[model samples]
Target chain A: MLLQASNLTIGYGNHIVQHHLNLVAEVGDLICLTGLNGSGKSTLLRTLAGLQKSLGGHITFRGKDVGKLTNEERAKLFALVLTDNIAVENLTIHDLVAMGRLPYTGWSGNLSANDEKIVKESLAQVNLLHKSESLICEVSDGEKQRGVIAKALAQDTPLVLLDEPTAHLDLPNRIEIMLLLRRLSVHTRKTFILSTHELDLALQMADKIWLMGNDGVQVGVPEDLMLTGKFQETFGSTAFRFDETDGHCKINHLLGTLTVAVTGESPATLWLERALFRCGISVVPNADIVIEAHQGCFRLQNQEVHSIEEVLHHLLC
Target chain B: MNRTYKNGLLFTGLLIVATIVFACDIVFGNVRLPLSALWSDDVLYREIIYNFRLPKALTAVVTGAAISVAGLIMQTLFRNPLAGPYVLGVSSGASLGVAVYLLAGSLLPIAFVQSGWGLVISAVIGAVLVLLMVLGISFRVRQAVSLLIVGIMFGQIAGSLVTILQNNSNPDSLKLFVVWTFGSLSAVSWTYMQVLVPLVVLGLFLTFFIQKSLNGLLLGENYARGLGINIGRTRLLIIISVALLAGTTTAFTGPIAFIGMAVPHLVRGLFRTSDHRITIPGSILCGATLLLLCDLATQLPADGYTLPINAISALVGAPIIIWIILKNK
Candidate 1:
């Protein structure tokens, strides 16, 4: 195992947030940790990174107790990509990434030729080498995040822990970051433990899921966790329901005044049902009002409606 | 790579400017001695050049470099652009010590407290006391800005205490205290430099040793610790170094301001980088040049009367800082 935690308790001061946890991460495993707000995700990541003291138990990496390792030793073992806002002025992307070699560099932090090569390679890995000379403030948010990840990559540690790496990104940027991490884990053969709220992406990409909830942490493969109802148990609520079939947590709509039958090809019907459900209309079989959703139009009671808006107008009116 | 080359050229240019300013400070005092007078056989001219002008010039260079470096360290440690050497009340603490020693002459042995060493010792004690309090509070305060506010509060408390002392002081001592508050670089002779130079050099050396950790801190404390930096130890080192540099300079110069608060910003604007490896040396050189120029302005040939060093520094530094703010904005 690359890392193992047994009977670990994590919290601040005397208050315990989590306890009696046993977790293992093997080489090349992309473990996605998902939890609701205030579920101790950040605390667990901090504890695992050895940045914070665990309340009890031990974390060992490669059979060595992590807490016992010196700071430099631990730095060589774990690299981190934090979600903290870095608004540093005048520091260029290269300068920021070059800092990752500080653990191995001399006291002056003068990067050697080898260290320079690594920094460049890390920047190139993130496709940020083109903007390496640009000041951090001049970069886009997604580019800045990529620079942070490049810094971690330059650190060259076997284990990388990212806390909400996609928190401040748009959808495409979020998917790109997740895909980048997946590719890095596969090619570099390094273990990754990242906490994210992107459940669908996590379900599709992660090798293992550490689902933290009020009851404790449930650890398993994503499909197994979904099949066994762990995701539902953790995330399902009165306002929303976790759809295990598609691995989506959808809002639970109330029963409406009208029940209509929605029939068409898949995907269009799926979206039409969602739209009808959101408008307080229930989709059922053998109803007075029937709607057929197609590629560009919908057939509603033998009238062709060009849009969901017109269909909703006919039904609601 | 290209930026390093440009910075190297900039460092050399600043060095040349500092040297020119240092020479000007030594040569262009009220007496207006020529550059060739150094080799002259006139006893009075030799006395002015070696005894008075040289020490004052050297003091200006040292004071400026030490205080500005302290300011840079504080700004990085607190992560506040407004943080300066005196922001933590070390100067106020030093001033309070001097005020008590000078104003309370009737309560204590006049001869002992009147000595130069006695004043320095008292000021250092006051500074260390405040530094200890600030350091203790730092462990409990997680936010940098909170510590800054606490320091400001401590400064206000010390200032009020000094006011009370002044009200009770005799006229002779009151006059002396007032002059000391105006700040002077000319008061530090070679005897005091023996103590001041080594301490400031030690502080500067300690700063160089932690340059890497200081750069790590640019990313903030959590990210720095993740890079294998010991946050507590780094903080302790920074606080101690600032105390040594700012405290000793304040004790000698009677709380010179503006240079500490402004020089780092000047260097940052000039170099356009916060990388400590460049800023540390850059601050040292730029600070020395700026102060030398300020001191020279104070001593413009005018019937042997000179402006207060504090007034001159503020006059020169405030505009530069304002320019930096507007330009960066």
Candidate 2:
């Protein structure tokens, strides 16, 4: 057991956001904390990072009470990559990552050769070594995020906690960050606990999911939680349905006045059904007007159309 | 390696400039004395050099270094570019103390109230009182910006109190109070330098101990804490150090302006890095040099009349700050 928390309650003064939480993270486990907005994902992460005081219960890291440890001791045990944007001017990526060695450095924060090697290695791990001399403000947001992750890596802690590491990133950048974290966790054998709203990616990638719901925190393997309908129970609404097989929360379209049958190749048909759903034309097995969607063109009533717009125009007209 | 070499050159150049300015400030006063006059047998020149010019020049150097370093710490602690030594109302508090003593001290029958030490003691006590209040508020407020706002409010309240005291003062005392507000490096005699030098030295020394903490704080409080810094303790030490440096300087020099607020920005621009290790010493040297130059400018007319050091600092420092802003933009 790397970290364990039993009967933990976390909140601001006089207002409890979460309670009766029993959570455990083993060595090398990528635990993804997921929840609705204001469901205490960040609060829990902060409490676990020892940045905030837990209202009740105890958090033990390596069988020792975390609250009893000194800040320097805790810093060696776990590092954090915060969500807050670092807008500090004139700080280079290398300089920012070098600060992670401060705990082990001298009073003046002069990095030793060994510390420099570690900082360089950390930057390389995040693929930011090439841009090490770039000022923080001069870099792209993805590069800045990588620089922050590099800083956390240079801390050389056994556990890394990230609060919404994927937030504010586009799709490819988000996937790249997640993949990098996963790779680091596997290669370094270090535990990572991150809170994120990316349910699809979290469900596919995380070793375990800590779903913070209305009742309490439900901890389980991602597949097990999905198979047991816990994801549906927690996140299912009138507007969307959680797909158990694909591990996706898909929007539930209302039945429309017009019905049309979508046919042909799977991926194309899938988008055609979506377009029909959006245009208030429900997809059915049989209809007077049938549309067959190929890769590039749509065959609607034996008349070929080049785009979904033409198909929608034929159906609506 | 290249950056370090450049910084070394910058420090060396600044030291040379500061030395030249210090010598100029000492030699080119109201009664312009030649370099050979220091070794002359003339009793009047010796008296002027040792008793008046040397102490005043030293006071300007110490005042510049102390207040500029205080401003740098406050800027980092509050993470506000505009933050300065007096941002926490320490100067205004000292001003209020002097106002009450000079304008209202006649009501008290004590003999000590009329002495120079009475004014210094009162100013320090007033500054500390405000510091204690600000420190108390800091513990309750989580954000540095909030503490900054509270400090500004404290300054406003203290300024209002000082104005009220001035309105009711006698003309003789009013003239004295107004002259004190004009600020003078020459007013600090050798006796005051004994106290001022050590306090400023101690404050600057304390800053070296927190050099890493100040750098960590530049990333903001949460990140600093994650890096194993105790934010509350760092803030307390920084606040105390600022109070000591700014409060003591204001007490002796009567609240010299612009040097504290403007010097750190100049040093930061020159260094092109926020690393406290560089900026701390850089600020000390740059601040001392800037004030020395300003003080020398006040004596440049070579007339017997001297301009207020406060006015000279503003006139000289403001344009440099404006240039830095425009260059950075």
Candidate 3:
């Protein structure tokens, strides 16, 4: 196992946020952790990164307890890229990324030719090479996010855990960030686990998904998850339904049929549907259709009401 | 990288400026030494330069550098732009310690001779005690506002205690405390300078040596922790450095204001980087220049009178802070 949490209970004070959680992550996997806000996802990641202490169980890295490992030992295993920008008003890109070598550098990074090469390549990897001279406070939101990733890449840990890495980015920036994580997972053969709200994107790139829901947490391949109809049980309520087979969410609204209807064979049928929609009536596309000429409609099955009075009676009924 | 070079250049420029300021400082003080008239064998000139004036200027420069660098470290570590050695109640706490020592001296014969060192040592202890209290409050409160409020409240408490001590003391002791409170470079005699300068040098040397760690601290605690820095340990190092730098200066100069708080921000504004490797050293030079300038201004001695150095610094520092905030807006 690259990193393992065994029977761990993590929380603040006596509150007990997550209890008896067990998980193992292998190298070279793109893992996505998805949940509602305040579901203890970030806390779990912090614990795994050794920033927070577990209440009862232990986190094992390479078969050794994480707490017992030296600081150097922990640094070799994981790098945590936080969501907050840290706002170091004066730090340069190169200098910020070089902070990764602190473990090996002891007191000074003492950048060897090799260290310099690695730092340059890391910036290039994130497409931030041009911003090396830029101060942290001067960069845009997207560039700041890239700068953070570059710092993580410089650390070059086997397992990288990011907390809501895409939380503050725009749509395009979010997709690009996810793709970057995917590439890093493959190119370096490192495991990347990130907690994010971009579920569709997370589902797209993830090798394995950790989905937390009302039905409790589940982890599996994306296809397997979709096949099991977990979304319907989890996110779907009375008002919302995940069209599992169709792969889209739908809302069901109740409104009686309109007296103003048209034949499917005519162009007027489309106009009739639009007219009903404008009147706050949902046009269930495949529902019954009636042709209205001279302000009268009759049911095909019952052969009834050919007048406006009968249609008004039906609406009252 | 450009900013680093810019910082280096600015720092050099400031060094030349500091030298000029120091020369003007030495030349303009109460008994002006004629720069052209003094020879190597001139007895009065030697006495005036070595015994009286030279130590004061050097003390001003070193105190400025030390206190400013210390303030920068405090601001960075706490991640609060408003944070300073004096702001965290250390100065008031140190004052309380001095009050204790001065008050104790009236009842005992040994009090007068040992009182000077006694005030300084107790002041350091008092500052450390308050630092711990602030640290404790910071741990419990995540909001910077609450922590700052607690700091201010703590300062009030220390101030009241020091007041009580001052009122209960003899007339001579009250006079000494009042002088200390006003803040001065002239009161720093050679013997006192011997103790003060070495402490400042040592504190700053240790801070510069840890420049890499300071840079890591710029990246936030989790990012820094991932790089194998023991966050708890680094914070301890910072506190110790702040204590040594602020404590020693407060002990000698009687809580000189604004040097620690203002210099770092001015350096950051000029050099435009948060990286401590340059910022720390840059703040030191800016501090030295400002202090020497203030020292010189205090020595104008119009009609045989001099201004308190603290008054001059507070007048300058308050608006620089207000300006930085407004500019940021």
Best by lDDT: 1
Q: Tens digit of lDDT per residue, candidate 3, span B13-99?
A: 998999889877766767766775345578877887777778888888888988899899878776778788777788988888777
For model 1 the interface RMSD, in Å, equals 0.8
What DockQ does each prediction reach against the true complex? 0.72, 0.66, 0.53
> Candidate 2's residue-wise lDDT over A1-317, tens digit each?
99999899999889999999999999999999998889999999999988899999999999999999887888888888998768775788999999889888878888899999999999999999899988898898889999999999999999999999989999999999999999999998999999999999998789999998977988899999999999888885789888757877778877778888888998888888888887778878988778887778899888999988888898887
Candidate 3 positional error at A69, Å: 1.9
lDDT of 1: 0.90
lDDT of 1 by residue, A11-31 (tens): 999989999989999999999
* Candidate 3 regions with alpha-carbon error over 4 angstroms: A214-216, A252-280, A284-317, B1-8, B37-40, B103-105, B110-115, B132-151, B166-173
Q: Best candidate, DockQ-wise?
A: 1
Against the true chain A, what TM-score does chain A of candidate 1 give? 0.96
Native contacts recovered, in order, as a fraction for each? 0.70, 0.51, 0.68
Q: How many residue pairs collide in each prediction? A: 0, 0, 2
lDDT of each: 0.90, 0.89, 0.77
Error of 1 at B18 (Å): 0.5
Residue A115 in candidate 2, Cα distance off native in Å:
1.5
What is the TM-score of candidate 2?
A: 0.97
